[model samples]
Target: MLPQHADPIVAIATAPGRGAVGIVRVSGKGLAPFVRALIGREPRPREATYGPWRAADGQAIDHGLSLWFPAPHSYTGEDVLELQGHGGPVVLQLLLARCLEVAQTALPGLRLARAGEFTERAFLNDKLDLAQAEAVADLIDASTEAAARSAARSLAGAFSQRVHALRDALIHLRMLVEATLDFPEEEIDFLQKADAEGQLQRLRSALAQLQAEARQGALLRDGLQVVIAGQPNAGKSSLLNALAGAELAIVTPIAGTTRDVVQQTIQIEGVPLHVTDTAGLRDSPEVDEVERIGIERAWQRIHGADAVLFLHDLTRWREPRYRVGDANILRGLPEGVPVLHVWNKVDQAGDELPRGDSDIVLSAKHGTGLDALRQRLLQLAGWQSGSEGLFMARERHLRALARVGEHLEQAQGLLTRAADQLDLLAEELRLAQHALGEITGEFTADDLLGVIFSRFCIGK
Candidate 1:
């Protein structure tokens, strides 16, 4: 009942299609007038009333339940109304159109809601912070039950609360440092103070621990990308088929049956693994241009992966000299990217499989040595598949934590320097605090919110 000029925004809150019910949501000021024009009665706040929804000309549309959540307490922190009707596509469309016509007459400033606009408004009104707001979408889009529960925890501010705790601790430390700086007489003592150094070390330790958790969470959310690469018929595809426990990839005795990179996504020990088996790398003069293209693309995938499993067929590669440029592949891979040397088809050559240099001899056909390979993969990923204490996170969160870590490292270096630049230390602490804030969206850009929420489904 606030005013007449604020146009109500309307959209179908429920997903499109036939279902048990569909929800049409409208939010804005002057919601009462819009409801009055549509249903001929103003609904009590937070009440559900069975009503016959109608058009501007007083024609019945559909019989449904109307819910009114008025003003600052609503999801978007506005006067909001929802109409739940039977969900036939045509019926839902007609109901939506009828409501829109009523809104157009009853309110002003109304327009089609943009992607994530409702959530954006909720954020602006302080109903939720950026991290919690993002969790709303994450929960809805969660692919697994565990993922949904983790996201729900984040939406409830579990992640943000921890971040805030760290922020508060950092602020206190910065205050103490700056206070000592104000008294130049004590600055020398403070610079050499054991307590001060101890506090800094403790803070760094806490940040490091948080970074580890954030990393685990990110892996839970994004999973790990593992690509298998080597010469043709080195059991790359066979290995994939074995791990997947199904015929996800076609394996034949003939080499090059897999012309393109074959991919399969499987959850092992709760860690999502995106496994790719690429076409073999060979220098065959008989091969055509298309095969060459696949080989080039194979290398690209290998370079982009989180980890590469370089397989060497022991029957063919008898000695270390015959090992497929094992040194060259290691050199080409980016530093810090883990490589697993797998000697496949070991069943064919028992004691002949190379023993030195961290090699695991396995037969993809018999599923021998698979458990060892799995353990190795989990180790490289920094945790076992389906490991406990995992949560859902993202690259944005990790990058923010990493920035904080870098700042802390830089501050430690400055503290050890000859100069007692307390001011510089304070600046680094501030930067670290800001970086941590970005993880929970206490400090962020509008574009970032757009990007994060845009990834959500339309109804969300």
Candidate 2:
């Protein structure tokens, strides 16, 4: 905790808007005097008391409900006070000003809270761990219902519980290895009797399973980026519209109808896919300046995409010039990005389909073949259909878990690929446990904690 964190803090807990009701919250070491001065009475603990909030002039500022929570039991593990009144911006601001004015005389060292300060206090007080603290922000910023549910689970400590389980098993293994290392004369017999090799294998298997699920959760939080790219009039915009079920982008027979990047987020099986439609990729002397810029941006988007839908016109499949253009687009595509070959205009192909392996054949105008495309997009995003009970994880969590797995792999190698030198094995186990601690913040740095909580809402 920092020196400034000791001061009493106040803020408008509700959103900045006009609604039926709003809240002005205060948290500090001893807020009873402030609450009594602001509301003309000290409300009972954990109970709402209706009263008229009075100013120093003995006039009513507003009539509202005041709820009090004594220290160590409140959200921030401090004495909490909430004033619920009308939800006008002016009303909230007045209440906030009133708190500051009263604080000058009643509650010393009081000030307005910074962004995420309230939640940071809660974390410092041990009311919630690092993972749950993150889920607080995730829940508020969730873009989809599935994401909200997963965040709720995480806030309730689902992710932390799994990490704790791993930690407990790890502790047991570390204990066995340490006991053996402390007595090297008994190291080999001790390890063989305790079945240390079997324990290591089982722990690694469990870690792999958790890592796989965390990857899926990460996709749910950070949606996949899919780019639609091809030559002019190849139905790129139509495919985007078909996926979105809306006319988001202009569709026409003209080449480069889409002169800019148009993006839409569509959920398939509750997993978000941010699909981008770009201008046609082509080389022609008749290209305009704006069209050339659009083509350059199209390549930029393609290079960044997790998956690229390289749409082709089935009606023009046999032409040598069209094939050359298609080959050019393929050559420009960045390596390692998964490309799905899609042949469009199937309804007008007249049975002369492209004689090659196409991932999908569709008529975007008629809304055909979209279901397969949606499933393929989900696959590319690594989403499993009907997956429930997932944790809302970030890239940092995944990296920590990966490092844990790596250390465990190294530990297994020390046990099998070397002599009975138990010291190195014990160090590997220590590193593995340290990595597991990072996920729940048992071994996190202060700067990392600052970065995590700084992203949260101020009122949290």
Q: Pick the candidate with the highest lDDT.
A: 2
RMSD of 2: 1.6
143-257: candidate 1 lDDT, tens digit per residue: 6665676778778887787788889888887877787777767536654553666777988898887778767766656668999988877889999999899988778888677
- TM-score leader: 2
Each candidate's lDDT (Cα)?
0.78, 0.88
For every candidate, C-alpha RMSD to the true structure in Å: 3.8, 1.6
For residues 1-460, write the lDDT of model 2, one tens digit per residue: 7898899999998887899999999999988888887887787899989978776787777788999999899999999998899998988888889999999989988998888888888888989888888889888988888988898998999999989999899899889888876776753667778888999899998899899888888888898999999999999999999999899999989777789999999888778889999999999997899999999999999999999999999988899999999999999889999999999998988876764564798899998888888887888787889898998999999999999999998998899843465788889999999999998888999899889987876677
TM-score of 1: 0.87
TM-scores, all candidates, are 0.87, 0.96
The list of candidate 2 runs beyond 4 A from truth reads 355-358, 417-420
What shift in Å separates residue 302 of candidate 1 from its native position after superposition? 1.1
lDDT of 2: 0.88
Each candidate's number of clashing pairs is: 4, 0
